[model samples]
Target: MGAQVFRAFRNFNLENRAEREISKMKPSPAPRHPSTHSLLGEQLRHHPEIKGEIASKNDKLLALLKDVYVDSKDPVTPVQVKDAETRQEPKEFRLPVGHHFDMMDIKNIPKGKISIVEALTLLNNHKLYPETWTAKKIAQEYHLELNDVNSLLKYFVTFEVKIFPPEDKKAIQSK
Candidate 1:
């Protein structure tokens, strides 16, 4: 009788072990295709405005393509010829407006009592949740006066960091 009891307990333990192993073997989800439409679908679920904007942009592109390819009888311009003769124009890359953060040297800032410049760097480097903080929020978090924050934000505008208001959920969703 004792031998039978021991065998039953051993079988139960084995079954539990097998069950645990099976639970650990979770299958990964199938990979989704990478496309602008797929990305837009994901983005648009949250930001309907962005979806409209993207639709408008697509319409414009289609119209432009129609004009160039369907309506025009002129010979196609070769990309190689264009590249060979095109002058290299210097276009400045500006940060978005109201963005006070600098990407470089942001990580060097100490956690508390960082310099204004360092604070800006941190803001640039970090992916910010706009809901919780705007440029004003960032300034407040760093213990900076409002005027100083505005001044710094203005400076960032010159660089074109693309700052938006905190309540702009569409911008966040699109990003």
Candidate 2:
């Protein structure tokens, strides 16, 4: 009878240990996402569709902002603002504007594999205009980020869409 009780007690201890081990193996719940008022959302790699939608929305917002804040064509330069006393006002400021690039003014690139930015520069240098060539088209063909494409386009316009880039005056030149 004593042996039987000892066996039963041993069984009970083993069952309790198994339960404890199972509890330990269970995973903890993921942390809850914080509200926008608390902090910006963390960037995640999953959900490609959602990311694409967000990127497109950002592009539209950027385009709208550019339209409202900047004019590429025929920008107005700021001159000295005269007060009633014929004194210049400190309020005089020029709006930052990019030069308008004529698409056709850009050169055509030869059929070859090259980085999109390099291809653009080459086309600008040769002044070979293609019927459907554009930064967006090039970006799509190369599977590149739209933001990168737009930035290069902005730089192209800033350089007056010329074949030669503006010399970097700040770079150290070896005498």
- C-alpha lDDT score of every prediction, in listed order: 0.61, 0.53
How many residue pairs clash in all the candidates, one count each? 9, 4
Q: Report the lDDT of model 1 for residue 162.
A: 67
Report the C-alpha displacement of residue 23, candidate 2, in angstroms: 76
Q: Give the TM-score of candidate 1.
A: 0.21
Q: How well does candidate 1 score on lDDT at residue 55?
A: 60
TM-score of each: 0.21, 0.20
lDDT of 1 by residue, 1-175 (tens): 9999998988887978998898896789976777866986878788889756756657677888887845567665798678979988764333222335554544333333455555556456433454555667766566556776656655653234667767746555553
> Model 2: per-residue lDDT, tens digit, 34-129?
675244333444445766676665767788888785547764444433334376545432221222344433344332234345545534633445
lDDT of 2 at 59: 69
Q: Per-prediction RMSD in angstroms?
A: 28.8, 30.8
